[model samples]
Target: MTQQIQQAIAKLEETMRSIGVLDFSGEVQLLEWSKSTSRDGPKIKFMMQDDDSVLPFEVATVKKGKMAGQIYHVFAIRVDDLPIKTNESEIIALEPAAKQPNRLAQAMHTDGYFRNSKLWTGMEIAEAYSQLDHKSYVEKLPCCGTKFAKHIACNGDVVGHHVKTSANSGIRIKPPHWYLVPLCHNHHMTWAHGSHAGSATHEDRHDLLLPHAVALTANQMKVKAKKIMGISSLSEITIELLDAFEEEIFGEAGNKYEDFK
Candidate 1:
């Protein structure tokens, strides 16, 4: 494998460890490569989809001038054969709108979520996530992955996470869309809202955050999207990852304390 391909593969391999995906091996196929111009000058981007035709882990490399970096990113909605959110029969896939409150809860509602009440409007629920986000591992649930819309109006509160795409770090070119990574309330409230954690090192907590998956997937989509749109700044795209934790718990948007009580 070429160094570029090796880098992409290596990143994919490490990312799969977090996503709990199967190893990708045998025949690292060349899917697509395109030449484009950004402020950074001439660039080449290659993309691949997980079709089950190949193993799940492979690197995607982006080259700019002489400098290069390997980034691993993921998308919540399963594309083609991706193991999560791709189910056609599921309510999230069939209804198309069951994305926010989370497809997992919808899929499990009949089995007894929301206290078996089923009062959910398919909208996102806050308390349901309290137990999940506290764990050290990054939130892996598709429903809780990330949430954002192009030109999403902000209420100014940190609602979700956005993957990094800086010229030096991940995406040299500004990504064209706003995204919401499903981050833990703790990370959002404690670290983001205030200062870093005490006992655990910042690097240690950072090792546990959402990484290249979302941003890289955005690049893959940009390949196919091929539409002219404004690119988001690196600072704008960087809220997705963090390396701190605190005891004070923040709350999610559109949540009612009375309901949870």
Candidate 2:
């Protein structure tokens, strides 16, 4: 393995440990380098264990650039011991509306929600959601709660739903849909692959892009709510609710909570 490849493996191992995923070992498989792609760019390929049952993953190295030294990206599925099927049609049906870019920007700018707020970032949100008291948020959402409600339950206040593009190799650039699902502490950890307790590792820290995920989740919730209520136009309702949520969490737009940094 190249030095770059070894470094990637170390980072991946650290991430797995930080997340409490045990005995998860795999090897890096190199792929053909493309001239169209930067020569300095690390090659992309799968990581698999001896069992070969787990879904193989694509691991990319961070060349010196925008994502220098970082594990540029990883696309993998959680290996489930049980049987599971991927329904392309169902996934396709969940595609976010064409207004996604606008919605994403709106979400990013919504003060108390993410960018400017101190109270909630990816880490804080994940910590808060993992608590036992915060289970309802995950159970009530259209995708998560609606789908897996019976398996989990909690009474904590409902934070917004989350949605984002799947970065896993097989599904890259598929539909960038919104998942109108609720999330609590436990679920958040599961979502982050960091449920096991301890400080996050370099990889885990990189994966903790909670603010971005939260913003997207909230936006997805707005879309789902609009669809459910049969509202003619979602812009007004989404903005109104988002404003109210921000006020409730951050006190006021400019107040600027201390926990944000």
Candidate 3:
């Protein structure tokens, strides 16, 4: 295995430990490197194993340029291939959406709503803009921005980007709502997948970004609590409330946000 793949697996193991998916003794093993048929790029595959359990995953590696030799995407792969059971009659006699066009349209609309709910609304995202400006933040950083500096906007759609993309170890799950921070579209895209040619990518930089997201989200919650509860003073925003939010959003490892300024 290459040094980059080994390092990526080590970091993945650390994440598992933090989330209690694995104990300190648990280790991740690289299974193989295979070519992706569609993208024609090499994929590094690994699995987390302890005494009795093994969970497999694969990450796409950046193939060229400054970001080359870095793990780009890490995703879980279910090793078990349990056969799915289905009723043949029910499958063959499925109801057509054309029979209930209104219901189908309604379902589509509701799905859209659910999709949008994955991220905080633009208004909620704007709350953290004052305390933590993502534009200025990413502009000064090397991992997320450089060439796109000229195109970065001061006023545009700010998204509620999650610090932790997934809820569990390498599994694809949406993170809790409260783990989001206000980040501009440019920075968000840059970090996730480089937005422009020759732009920087995530490449182990989530460590630098996650803490900032946690801190800003906590502060934004405090401000929100002050406004909604009619608390006259920022000092009046109780620590208990922030603690509860952190525990709900950040799980067990959330940082102290009361003095995040």
Candidate 4:
């Protein structure tokens, strides 16, 4: 590793120790540094061994620093202090950012914590759903299609349903928001959950909603790209950029629908 990165890692170690990060000991190992993207700045990954598992820390350079507009590394206190002798899971749970993929998931790929770093919490997905037009986004769900329209109108209680359960690994962790689709109570549970046998399965819902989810993500990326790149034409957005944005959601190739199932 370069001298500067080594220095940064040393400084991070010091910060963690001083902040009482609950048994922050052992060597601080570099995991991976996710390259900078239009939507997000660069992220640095490090881990401190605890026992059988290690505690990971994902840090990013300050976009706006007080030092003459220079973007530099600073150990900004995310929380007042971590609980002493806290377990790895609890320590991770304490970190709000640790739950999402943006930085944590990006770092996780190298450590096998997650295959995809573009997952979202249920609340985040719900917020996105809230911002969209009900008719276009929610009403268009496979469950709400013309075929099902006669059987059951949307009932106006749309909720975000995760396309893959394995993405979370368990019920405790929230699924990524990108792999979510809006579905009413009946579709989400009654049909999708297999309560109504032979009805639309989760896979069916995923197939129907995948295109819409991709389009929504692409549109969001375009907006961010335009602002960051200062471009107007939609055609200016490159496929590589779009792919990167998709990676931010779906993660690497193994995270696709087929792999998830």
Residues 179-219 of candidate 1 have per-residue lDDT tens digits of 23433454444443435443223442343232333332332
The lDDT for every candidate, in the order shown, is: 0.29, 0.36, 0.39, 0.41
> Tens-digit lDDT track for model 3 on 50-157?
211221111112334433443324454322333323753121211212322233223323443212322233324445223244333323223322222334432445
Clashing pairs for model 4 are: 119-176, 120-176, 120-177
Evaluated against the true structure, the overall lDDT of model 2 is 0.36
lDDT of 2 by residue, 157-185 (tens): 44443334334113444212222234455
Residue 90 alpha-carbon offset, candidate 1, angstroms: 26
Per-residue error (Å), model 3, residue 68: 32
Candidate 4: worst-modelled 10 consecutive residues by lDDT = 52-61
Please identify which of the two predictions, 2 or 4, would achieve the higher lDDT against the true structure: 4
Cα lDDT, model 4, residue 217: 39
Best by lDDT: 4
Candidate 2, superposed: residue stretches over 4 Å from native: 1-201, 208-234, 237-245, 248-250, 253-261
Any idea how many clashes model 1 has?
A: 17
Candidate 3 versus the native: TM-score? 0.27
Q: Rank the candidates by lDDT, best first.
A: 4, 3, 2, 1
What candidate 4 gets wrong by more than 4 Å, as runs, is 1-151, 237-261
After superposing candidate 3, which stretches have Cα over 4 Å from the reference?
1-157, 165-169, 195-205, 227-230, 234-261
What tens-digit string does per-residue lDDT give for candidate 4 at 1-261? 466766776677667644434222233344556668997777767553331122111111122332122133444333224454455322322332332223322333344322122332221343432233323443333333223223444454667665564544466675445545566776666655654655665666556555444434333333333333333333243444434544444453333223222
Which candidate number maximizes TM-score?
4
Pull out the clashing pairs in model 3.
Answer: none
In model 1, the Cα lDDT at residue 89 comes to: 30
